[model samples]
Target: MQRRKYLKGMATAAGIVTVSSTGNAQVWDSDELSKGEEPKNPSPPRKGDSVMGLTDQIDTVNVGIIGLGNRGFSMTQLIDAMAPDKGVIKAICDIREKPVEEMSDWIKEEGKNDPPATYSGSKNSWRKLVQRDDLDLVFVFTPHQAHTPMAEYAMKKGKHVAVEVPAATTIQECWTLVDTAEKTQKQCVMLENVCYFDIEMWVLNMVRQGVFGDKLTYASGGYIHNLVAEYFFEAYWKDWRSKNHRKYKGDLYPTHGLGPIAFYMGINRGDRLEYIASQESPETQLTERAKELPEDHWAHGADDWANGDTTRSEILTEQDRQIHLQFDVKTNRGYSRKNELAGVDAYHEGFPSQLAVDSEGHGFVDDATYDQYYEEYRHPLWVQMEEIAEEYGGHGGGDFLEIYRLFDAFNDGRPPDMDVYDAAAWSAVRPLSATSIEYGGIPVKFPDFTRGDWQNKRKLQVMDFDTI
Candidate 1:
């Protein structure tokens, strides 16, 4: 693929152009557009308005999901169950042939005669899938490194793309993905499953409704895990987690922790990310253990590739709010997926082992508060999520919800809840935080992925499944 000279003004191609309004005039460029022109009729408002009074688009979006690995396969199944009536999986691609065949077989077993066409080969095979005229959206589920390139190619090919978490691994890649999405005028959603979790959504609603009252001095976002036993170390692809282990030694996978917090805190929305300073534990357990093992062992003699056990990034939002973001992939101790939000009036917490919300005077309480809360504010569409989970379950019903929203956005012609800017903001933390680590844990400024207009942009369209 020829790397086009980076254009300064807006990019235009194939009648699909990104126009940015600086001052009172609109400037345009065509370097990124497939054909150096703007689409004659760029996505217009849908015709028939729905009960939610949202857009009236009803096109059946044809999807092609690339990199059918574990997450991709789960997303495919979720899409199959969630939006069967709204969209169809037209194609699936992966570097490995086994996953493609497995997904095809699964589709057939589900009684769908016209299973999505399967393609496998090099990393670039994704380009072919995205370019297909039949595909409206492309899901890139490959490793972190491949995300930006695939998304760039997909958007240029006139296909919307939804990539897995940690959208890009470098600051440059993050800006490129965001820039290309805007340049191509195509949707680029980051599939952050945790954002769609039931508990997280409930908390968001509560926060929005002022149930949390003025959030102040919050401690949220943490990842406590022992992933050394995972197949990531032994995979045939030599997963980037194993390959580039040394380079990204701090908060390498911060999205899992940062996603929900950013949403709740309104980062890039009501609040903007300012700067973050990170600190990693001096030594890693994996490195010490690896040194004790024989040289031939999978992890042995790989001390140079080991990252610190714990990385804590302190983020300061433009709102003057503080966030304690923690990412750890070492140790088999306590299992925790932290999502604790502290506020002036109230607080909510969610670790993998438990969930809790507290008011200042109330002190520690039981889980019944959350249960009652869920019962009261639960969206009617949420029940459908359970049904979909029964049909295809993964990641505690999160995988299904992610795909459900993807298809829902496509059919409704609205930006997804986690759109391009959201993807860039959430995932960019990985690289920015890494930069902080490289600079002796100094503060790193997060580049605004939206280039400063995300605030004026409409709130992402959350699927209103109530009427469906």
Candidate 2:
């Protein structure tokens, strides 16, 4: 594959060029991928990068999982269904006893292996589980607050870490994971399943192949799912998604929207986030809903619903690319990811499915043409693994695919596709957006979790991860 260059001038200064127009959308592109000039490749493996990619080759990975909430149970079920041959659940930890027992029993019921030691009954019980030496990989599916600390501790204990998204809730924690992963050489990957989503990865394959002209300029997405019912349901917990409405603001969960776009744009690989500015919609929707609740209801109380009903953040990269992110959890509207990608002569947009200009700047493609595109551009990894992935299940089999690749990478003596730098970078969006939101949409710079190494060394190597 050819080394790609940064679209610094193109992304920053290129004006929109109108090629031709369809019904509602315009035929416009800024820079085509193949038209860009090549830049020199950065040195391979910068300092402190020895531990950044793949771990030392290992045999079967032994697993210890923490948290048995919604995501936790799903992961447990995934392992139960798919990972028996590749790894063992050596230990399990969850604050909730019921799910833990259920998982332990499920593992045993399947007769895959011996039932693992289980931990519950206390908040600190996970620490004990982490201390065990038998665990080769510690999976953290706990609440948002525990992600960083648990991952840090597990890496220190000589275990690779696979935690749920936003690997850290704070910038300092992002730094902690970065520094820790460098010292430990134990992999820390945020299980961002969206990166493996069917449609997303299809677009990623096209982007990587430079199908859409390489001088990439803009990308946008959203986490706009209506959660009114989930928020007001009687069983809602403070630690989960429900109560977060009344707490912090600014895209609380950003990795889903950011992950795929960043990959397509080579963020943290060649480009870096320069600064961020965010603005939030009013918190009126949640408050209006609270009006109908009884006085004793949690929503009727004085909790601080600091988060806006919707937030849109504009982020600029050092390479001059632009990213527009949206967050709208409080609305009554259905879920949508307003995913859009644009370059010199090709672009895409969404309300439902996207209408994209073909790679050769031919014309706009509508939803009716999606099947042919899917047939042509589906990621090769998905082509090979989607069958088994669908059987194991998760966000359109993304969960199974990611887990499969993790194990495959380990057995193959290579790093899994996602590393600690990617984890921390994607995870930091929430807290960073929070800081930017609080100060009236001021420009806040994101930390370089890879230090300065991202400038030269970190290129996306998808072919290395091209197996199940």
Candidate 3:
């Protein structure tokens, strides 16, 4: 009612209690916000008929990978540099037989005349490499609760997928990855490599050329990287991310600060998020820094440590926009991904990165002018994938320009600019920020995985650089 009494009278005139873990001070009127729920993702036999758009091209693809430790053996060396042109690694799984014999000796030191068929035996040998018939796509670097049931069993066993990231962990596994990519129409994607970072696509091409004239409201990032001892031996596999930081509490690794601010806040396409509040920040050094390691370290015998080495969450959109994110993966911090963007005129307080504008009203935009706004708004897919994504070094080339613009938007047939409704609304910010920080932070709402087709969809246009 009356915008929740004008946001609780502007947080009680600044005493600032916008609800953050406490007795969750009721408030949510309007019949519980009209019983929210429309952000899509929830059909599967709402009668098979599922297809959404585009999705069909192939042209040599063939790939298949399923966790050979660390992002499916670095995406099988990006399909061994796209197997002598284009694609083909055909198969490779890993219940771990020494990373399936070191990815079969890197496919015989990349001399593949047609090699790759390995599968470290059952744990559902990636269901026989996604029922391959000479594959087409399957990727899925497993273990995020096995990304939406292994990408809904490789798009219902017809292939074409691409897991990793909170591709699905709830929101009913993101509506079972949107009813199995719409009843097997295929194409899944969600490997959200920081929405193909290149200075966050030049702050999303300077807010799509308006140069932040106003309205793009807010966004602030943070995956404050400090994976203490980098990746704690990937929580010794069977222990998966330290038993999900001892069974979640909040933002347990939100998609690299919620995927480049949900791709510059184009959210599903028009804007969605709606509600979500979170808090956390207390649970000092994950189990006292895992008892200072060395118990033959396999996450040094994990114990109760329900996340929040620092959580932050906060988001709301349906046009009013606003965001916050941040989730410090147990810190001593070093890698910062905090890129803020709050426009009315301009604002960008990111990791030592700044930007002010409104004609420098109060001034502040200088980190030596970020290479002059990266040579004036680069992003033509970083001028053709920054020399092959800085030779495949994740992030500084966002995992090879998010796998070559997701396999050139799936071999040019389109439909894959991160789909399945942006992987269930950006992996439903880790189970709605752990049920709004265990009901004490309040306001959760968010679903519209684009059922109403994101009010006209089509924006966030990455890659179309004159047909590459």
Best by lDDT: 2
RMSD for each of the candidates: 10.9, 9.0, 21.6
Q: What is the lDDT of residue 3 in candidate 3?
A: 49
**lDDT per residue as tens, model 2, 1-468:** 212333333323321121111101111123542456422212223335445555567677788999988888888878765456677788999887898899898888888768899999998999999999898998999878789999999999999999998798776687778777877778998998888888888888777666677688999987888886677876564566665666777788898888888888888777877656788987887677778888887777544678888899888787778999998887778787877888875676655656566666666786568777778888888888788889888887989888877877777777688888888778777877876676556555566666675776564655444453
Model 3 / residue 351 / CA error / Å = 45
lDDT of 2: 0.75
User: What tens-digit string does per-residue lDDT give for candidate 3 at 108-216?
Assistant: 8778537788887679888887897888888888788888888888778788888888887777778777776777778787787877777777877787776677577
Ranking of all candidate structures by their TM-score, best first: 2, 1, 3
User: Which parts of model 1 are misplaced by more than 4 Å?
Assistant: 1-58, 231-233, 292-295, 352-360, 367-370, 457-460, 463-468
Q: Which stretches in model 2 have alpha-carbon errors above 4 Å?
A: 1-50, 301-303, 358-363, 366-369, 457-459, 465-468
Task: Please give the range of 10 consecutive residues that has the lowest summed lDDT in model 2.
Answer: 18-27
lDDT of 1 by residue, 1-468 (tens): 112321122133211112111101122224534444432212222222211212325488778889877677777777666446877788989988889999999987886437778788776677778878987778888888898889888978978788887787766676666667666667777888887777777766666667767765575787787776552346631676666556556677777778878777777666777667777786566566667766676677555654677889888776667888888766766766688887665677776323345543655555686567777755444555677654566677777776777677667666567766677667767766665666566555566555555455245345344333
Which candidate, 2 or 3, has the higher TM-score? 2
